[model samples]
Target: MNNEAIDIILAEDEPALGMIVKESLETRGFKVRLCNDGAKAYKAFEESQPHALVLDVMMPELDGFSLAKKIRLENEQIPIIFLTAKSQTEDVLEGFDVGGNDYLKKPFSMEELIVRIKNLLNRQEVQKTAAIYAIGDYSFNFPKQRLTYKDDEEVKLTHRESHLLYHLLQKKNKVLDRSFVLKKLWGNDDFFSGRSMDVFVTRLRKKLAKDDRIEIINVRGYGYKLMVP
Candidate 1:
């Protein structure tokens, strides 16, 4: 990954710390957008579609967890790092639960942050490289968000649908944990997210219904299995 081409949104309420972090990242060849509040950071995210995000947990208007949840609704792949003074186990778990890729405690080294960002971007690049999958008689091109059946019928998938299908394909023939999929795709395993996942599963089933060999089966208490025979 080229640091110069990477854009990062850094959301911190403290002006001094924000500038220090922004300047440090910029010095390392990253393009940094420094926003003082979570709301402004979100606006910057919507506008720039940055490569990654570094957010402070305590911010006005929208907290880091809330902002991350909102962003996950829009994009599941974008790397998000949360910075906070609170280092409790629950806080860290909450960060991940809200779709944060990494959690950094306050008084952290800039070098560590840079390394984490690069690592995430590299992983994302690898996923992009392996974007296509074959399921029974259907072909899924994740990057293009297109699913083709028998080389003729084509189904365009939304971002969520594409990700959901990708997860299912990864665990084909085996049960994919419902809670795991919900957390990965919807940022949380809440009631509404569960309902959303169910709806997407149905949509995917309908799209792949052309081929009877491909079936997304509910594992009852577990999750779903994409059985491709």
Candidate 2:
């Protein structure tokens, strides 16, 4: 809702349907770019890096799931909403499993789509808090999206990784409740998101492994504690 001309990449093969959705969003002050195939959509996404992505499940060259995986490697926090005709319990679960924020069945109302986009964007704004956090021998800057290793090497962290690190460091020396972390960082404690969080913790462990004095201790069924000696 800032009316700041949100950029979106619409990947739908049906020419007429694609135009309708594109125009509808554009009418509401969004900047929409349409791609007829998944390959082109990926290329467009790489070039534009839109605020949110609307992808069709079935497409040429590559499917929506494939395109999403590639996008997640480079950009982690950007909103991804799957717009597809495949409406099954498993399908929805699969979409979220692959890092999607939301999944919409085809024939969805424009109003519903708009609401989901707004929700995703608003959640993103909330998640963007303090950029720089002090960890052992490293400064984690979430906004710049970089991790400085104190002249050793500057490594970049994915958005989720950076945010997860910040949350843990903020609670340094105290036990960070796992459920609290899952809800705060990912906005959900669902199975897929929980697994995704585990992956992030593993990556963070590698990043912080250089410092012997710093440790991330799993508190059994509770959560984690970041300790500095």
> TM-score: which candidate is best?
2
- For 72-123, candidate 1 gives per-residue lDDT tens digits of 8898789898899996656765776577767778899999889878876875
| Per-model TM-score versus the true fold | 0.60, 0.66
- What shift in Å separates residue 140 of candidate 1 from its native position after superposition? 13
Model 1 whole-model lDDT (C-alpha atoms): 0.85
Question: Which digits, one per residue and each the tens of the lDDT, describe model 2 over residues 1-229?
Answer: 5645678899999999999999999888889999999999999988886889999989999899889988888887888988998866567656765767777777889888887788778868866765576677887777655788776688876545666777788789999999998876555687766666676677788888888788888898888888975
Report every candidate's CA lDDT. 0.85, 0.80
Using lDDT, give the best candidate's number: 1
Cα misplacement distance, residue 11 of candidate 1 (Å): 0.1
User: CA lDDT of 159 in candidate 2?
Assistant: 48
- Tally clashing residue pairs in candidate 2: 0
